[model samples]
Target: MTEIIKAESLSFDTLLEETSFTVESGSTSIVVTGKEEVDACLVRLLLGFIRPASGRLFMFDTDISTFTDRELSAVRQRIGLIYASGGLVSNLKVWENVVLPLAYSNKFSREQIEQMGLAVLNRLGYSGKLMALPGHIPLFQKRLAGLARTMLMDPDLVIYESPLTGLNYNERNQFLRIAREFHLEKPGRTSLFLSSTPEIVPLLEDARVITFTQRQSS
Candidate 1:
C-alpha cells in the first residue's frame, strides 16, 4: 500500500500539534480531536484549502506547503469533500445539485448532465423527489445525493468533515457501509474522516486513527 497522505510533526497555528501520520492507498483514516476549530483546521490542512504555520504535509506525494495558489487549486480537483450538512445548495433541486460541478464546468449538454446525475443518485439509493429542493428531503438522502455528486467526479481522494454529525446509529452504520463500499470500488483510492469526538472510534472498523488531545506549541 502506497502512502497517499503524509504529515510530519504537523502543527497548525497553535491549534493542533503532533500530527505525524501516513494514510496508505485504498485505506481509511480517522482524525479525532474533539475540538471544532482544530478539526476544521485539520480538514483545511488536508484539503490544501489552508496552509500550516509549521511542519509539513504531503498529498499524493506533493508538498502542500510548497504548492502555489494555482497549483493548490489544481490539486483540489483530485479531491472530494463531504460536509455534515451534505453541502448542497438550498435553492437548487436535488438533481440539479447532484451535477452542480458539471453544470459549472459546462463540459456537457444539459441532457447529458441530467442523465448522469439521475443515474448516480439512483445508484446511491436516493429515492426522493429528484426535482425537490434539499430541504424537502431526508437528511440521509441529502447526504446520499452529495455522495452521488462526489462519485460523479471520480475523485482520487475523499475528505469527510463531520459526516455523521446529525446522523443516528443506523444512519451512521448505513453511511459507513456505503462509504467503505465506494472506497473499495477504486484501487488506490483513499478516504479521510475528520471528527471532533473520540466517540466515533467505536463506530469504525479496520481504520487508522490519529488522536490529538493536547494543544502544544513550540
Candidate 2:
C-alpha cells in the first residue's frame, strides 16, 4: 500500500522542552526525545489535528503544512476521529451523533445518512441504542457509539484517543474485537491511529503499537 502519511525530522516545543520524532505510514513507529508533557501534541500531529512547528508532513502525497484551514477541512473530510471522551453531543440522539459529521458537511442525503448510521451502528453492536442520549448509555455502549460515529463517514483514516479507557476487561476485549473487525473489513482502506498510555501495551499488541514499543523495537 502507498504511504498515506509521512513525517521527517519533526520538532516542536510545548509547555516544556523541545521534542522530536519521525513517522511513516504502514507502521505506527514513533520516537519521543523529550518529556512526557509533549505527548499530546505528538498525538495531535499524527492525526492531522495540527501542524508540526518544523519538518515535513505529508498526507497521501501532499504536504499538510501547505494547506489552509479550508484546505485542511477538505483533507479532514476524508478522515475520522474518536476523541478520548468519544466527542458525542450530549443533546444529540445516538443516531444523530453517528451521522453528525455528514450532516455538518451536507455530504449525504438524510435517507443516505440514516442508512449509513444504521449500518455502522449494527456493525458495531449498537443497533439498539440509537435513540439514547450520550449520557444515558453505558461506557461500553458509548465507546461503540463513538466507533460508529467515526466509521459512519467511511473515512480513509480513523484516529482514536484512549478508546478503551474506563472499560472493564470484557468490554476492552469487545472493543478490540470490534476494532480488529473494522480493520479486517477495510483491509488497508483505512488506517487506524490509536493513542493510549503504556499500561495498554499487552492489549494493543496485535496493533502496530506505536508509543513505547517504537523505542523498544528500535
Q: Write down the TM-score of every candidate.
A: 0.87, 0.75
Cα RMSD of all models vs. native, in order, equals 2.5, 4.6
TM-score quality measure for candidate 2 = 0.75
Candidate 2 on 1-218: residue-level lDDT in tens? Answer: 56776556565554322233333344332232233434456557765686667777777678887888898878887777676566788999877887887798787898888888777777776645678888887777777787887776666666666655577888778777776566555555554544444555566565544433223222
Question: What is candidate 1's TM-score against the reference?
Answer: 0.87
Error of 1 at 199 (Å): 3.8
Candidate 1 colliding pairs = 34-196
Q: Top TM-score: which candidate number?
A: 1
Which segments of candidate 1 are over 4 A away from where they belong?
105-107, 135-138, 215-218
* Candidate 2 error regions (>4 Å): 14-40, 47-49, 102-109, 127-129, 204-206, 212-218
